[model samples]
Target: MPETVFEVDVDEDPEDQPDPIVNRWHPDTPPAATIKPGEKVRIECLDWTGGQVNNDDSANDIRDMELSPNHHLSGPFEVKGAEPGDMLVVDILDLGPFPDHEWGFTGIFDLENGGGFLTDHFPEARKTIWELDGVMTHSRHIDDVRFPGCAHPGIIGTAPSHELLEAWNEREQALIDRGPDAQTGVNHETGDDEPPLALPPEPENVLLGDMDDDKLEDAAKEAARTIPPRENAGNCDIKNLGRGSRVYLPVFVEGANFITGDLHFSQGDGEITFCGAIEMAGYIDLKVDIIKNGVEKMGTDHAMFKPGYQDPDFSDYLVFEGYSVDEDGTQHYKNGNVGMRRACLDAIDYLTNFGYTREQGYFLLSTVPIESRLAGVVDLPNTCVTVSVPNEAFDINIDPDTLADDSVVTDRSDVAKPS
Candidate 1:
């Protein structure tokens, strides 16, 4: 079948705007456009800061910007045949910066806010500007490094129905109800300052007083936020989902109301620092299809995926190990957040010894393609976590094509090994 193409650009104009950029991913957010199941879509997205942090923005600008309701998305493009319980197959065909602007930024969250992985060690907020050249990215802060870009939409998912939305809130709220002292292990901070675990009350859609059922329904629709990745897969920031990747998201609402944004030029796993990754404003070319009765057939609750990468370079990595246990013999292994934080701190410590400042090391860790893995969860006293940074990303003179050989090992062979 001949594929139909639809375009949804960022509405920067003051008047006559047909399509608008939406910051929240509520089910009621009207579709910017609609297309058949087999059609293609070219969506233009703003950066995670929604144009607030420009290429020339300073660290203070990043610190001052209102980051709530972030991940400025382009569309909730309705798939003509998609319905609840079906699966939306999104084939990411292409992704990159917009033609006119080929630059992006990376930064770390402040300490006062929900601190980053290495917040206690590197507490200050910082920003780095990255210049994009096709599939390569170079940052002025780290002049000695340049790596091949792996651009992808950090946030991509379908809107949740009212029932599913309520379930998400209730579950998340239950976790929040277990006070900070409770060992819930999940990151409860949803980037909002409201009560009941940052899950804000739904905004009243249009005060339709004197109404009964419609008013309640409107309030329910406004409850879904864009922060957490639920069964509908709102912000699953998996870095490997580049072009040619296929994402399968369980549909909860009719038409699916598929939306995407938070395009990153490059990022590491875990995004340990809240603002980690080269945040970019770019265009995504996607081909969407639907699988009928996908929930029952796939046997999955939320979104699953087959990631694709163009010419993936498999080089040796400088692995840094960490353990989430105190010297007093306490283990925190329920959610893996504590383990991940320790891993990032270890990576930063290793980088500092290589002549980089603590801040520089933290920024580099955030921007580079570092992979954080749970090395051992079954260990009784401590949960082991490993942060692996690719060796090729360093400035050391090495052949890119030959770096994948097993004989080539990272320089830090003498570092403390994981038990």
Candidate 2:
């Protein structure tokens, strides 16, 4: 393990500070701290909601929480030798709860706001608290279910370049303009056409240190909200990025301006229900390095440049399958997002059959270390997606014999002799 050179305490206050943590990632936002590559920095991070939710298990705190400038990121730690077009390799050296505060949360967002996987089916706002012990976590809301603690930073990324920020906003706005009905593939009889929420405009005069005149432009300072992950790797809620994992993120600005927050004590893949994922305040020790011209030298495409992890811990899985087709057998292969959504819903439904209610099933799917995998994409009419839950996490006997057969007959014997 590398020795820590710098530390950020999340609870420190500057005598009535307006915002405790930097809320946006931009090149113009001056680096909070700078450390050379290979030097380790330990950051004390707040949960996704900052400090709004307390240990009292308050659901209203989550429901009434402000959404703007969300995911309180710790630092835009400038790597000494890093520059644009390089690959920032962040080693997940260590993760754990902040001193004396061993707790976290999981929940589902209301449908009227930004909805989640099963928003239409389960639209109520809910929350579940998890108590984190040494290497295990147990929730009182969901009885008789406990899992090992797998902690990691949920939001980790570098700031996007000025041009990349514009491109992101333009593309995301186009998708939002398509309206909920068009995107979800469900027709509304009443035609309630609500425009998608616009990305908050970037703040002005936020520059904290000496900056070049060009870098201070409005366009240069502004960036798209950190909701979706892109080539720059912001808000990628991957569960496998725990201790010992190495994540490579493409750098678009000088210093790679690395930032991280939204610490999760444990989270499942897909993060189906948005609100909750064992959210926690913790410390993460990251060892950073830079790979120069990684994009061109590696021939990496845009989508492939997001973030790649290595040497993740693996386990046996109890898998559930979902297809992107209607009950009447109509296939909808065009939209893969909707397909993945259906797969998540199916996984939650399968959990319900095992005595978990619809809400509990959603909560279990979010907090546990489950993974969502695209099983098959080439199947003609219907695309297959599978949610794999680690069998080791639970003590209950989920018999493989009782589950539905996921095998597909590939025999071509019935093809009529080529006419």
For all candidates, the clash counts are 0, 1
What tens digits encode model 1's per-residue C-alpha lDDT throughout 98-188? Answer: 7788888877666665456666665666777888998888776665678887678889998878777677777776766763423343435
User: How high is the lDDT of residue 330 in model 2?
Assistant: 70
For 1-419, candidate 2 gives per-residue lDDT tens digits of 45543344445532123333556666666776788877787776767666666555456655565666476667777888787877888888788887688988776766665667677776656777888987689876666577886677888888888888778777766765554553553435555644354444455423222345565566434655667777877788887778887878887888888788888888888777886578988788888877788767767623222222432254777777777775455778644566676666776676654556677778888888787777788877667777887766655544466456344221211100101
CA deviation > 4 Å runs, candidate 2: 1-20, 180-190, 193-221, 301-316, 327-330, 400-419
Candidate 2 weakest ten by summed lDDT: 410-419
lDDT of every model, 2 decimals:
0.69, 0.68
TM-score of each: 0.82, 0.82
User: Measured by TM-score, how close is model 1 to the native structure?
Assistant: 0.82
**Which run of 10 residues does model 1 get worst, by summed lDDT?**
410-419
Clashing pairs in 2: 107-276
Q: Kindly report which residue stretches of model 1 are placed more than 4 angstroms away from their true locations once superposed.
A: 1-18, 180-198, 201-221, 326-335, 397-419
Instruction: Identify the leading candidate in terms of TM-score.
Output: 1
